[model samples]
Target chain A: NSKVIQTPRYLVKGQGQKAKMRCIPEKGHPVVFWYQQNKNNEFKFLINFQNQEVLQQIDMTEKRFSAECPSNSPCSLEIQSSEAGDSALYLCASSLSRHAETLYFGSGTRLTVL
Target chain B: GDSVTQTEGLVTLTEGLPVMLNCTYQSTYSPFLFWYVQHLNEAPKLLLKSFTDNKRPEHQGFHATLHKSSSSFHLQKSSAQLSDSALYYCALRYTGANTGKLTFGHGTILRVHP
Candidate 1:
């Protein structure tokens, strides 16, 4: 059965507004990842975390975009100011370890910025 | 930095026809290769993963072999099915890097016509 869950299956935001998406990783999974899929079907790695610490994030994500996986709380990715270019499918995935022999993904949150 | 290249942007095949999707990678270190399939409006799911100890990985009648010399892990199937129609992405995780992020290819859309 699928374990990863993402809230707000679809989101619509206006330009300059904040867009936030949440994810719940599978139980006992310590590693979580986020990616963005664009219209061209390209998957771009956004950020990843191990436990409660941020591991690696891309340059584009270092600014404007803030993400955290707090202990006992759901992981989240937030866009400070939504842009039409930010409109895409945000995917959340979880793995048992950072090595990630396997990864389970949620249905994803499709964000539309107008 | 690790990178993956999926030669085909799209493939159209008839049911029961042989299928092969080319995937090649570039990494300084021995990389962990993976194949993920995404149905429309769905999150990508792991289809096959390369284990260092295993020569070939197979799932759901799909299989791939990791060749270190070629830096390739091409996904192949004996026959294509209509259900197999989806977007396939090839990804790689560099063990040499401390990050758990996976670099993905542009993805290939497979259309199996009945």
Candidate 2:
């Protein structure tokens, strides 16, 4: 069974609605990362968190998108206002170390914006 | 910004044929390279990674050699199987960073026909 777990395998939200996805990292893994995979299979890095602390993120993660990895809780990525461009597969990954040499990923949450 | 380049969009082959996927990157600092495979309806999984120059990294039936001079880590396999058909992504991360986030390339779809 996959160690990394993501809830709500699929989500459908209309434009301007809120969309939230949650993830649980692998046991003992401290670094968690979120990536967006588009229909063309292009992967985009969204955010990284090191045990509840923001490590690095891209421009798309700001203002509209909010992500948090709280201690003893599942990490979540939320979109305040969904757009058609935001419809994609959201993947969560965790690494044994902060170096990101090897990562374990979840099945991902497929989000669709209409 | 660090970036990975993969020219191939799709590759079609028959079973037992050899497979080679091109991967190259540009980075300002020492970089770590990786290959990820995503099966149908499955999450992207790490297949291999390389940090040491000229050293090859192999997982399952796939292998890649890191060539620093050419900045390439092309994946290769002796023979392809129908099960091997999947989407492959090449990624890179800075080896000397506190925030080691991956920059991914446009994925290549490998279709192995029986």
Model 2 chain A: lowest-lDDT 10 consecutive positions: A95-104
Docking class of 2: medium
Distance from true position, residue B61, model 2, in Å?
Answer: 1.8
Mind giving the per-residue lDDT tens digits that candidate 1 earns over A6-111?
Answer: 9889999999999999999999999999999888989998999999999999898998899999999999999999999999999999987777457789989999
Residues A35-98 of candidate 2 have per-residue lDDT tens digits of 9999999998899999988999989898799999999999999999999999999999998767
Model 2 lDDT on a 0 to 1 scale: 0.91
Candidate 2 deviant stretches above 4 angstroms: B51-53
Off by over 4 Å in 1: none
Question: TM-scores for chain A, candidates in order?
Answer: 0.97, 0.97
> Best candidate per DockQ, number?
2
| Candidate 2 residue-wise lDDT, B1-114, digit = tens | 689999899999999999999999998887889999999999888899895656678889899998889999899999999999999999987656577688899999999999
> Which residue pairs show backbone clashes in model 2?
none
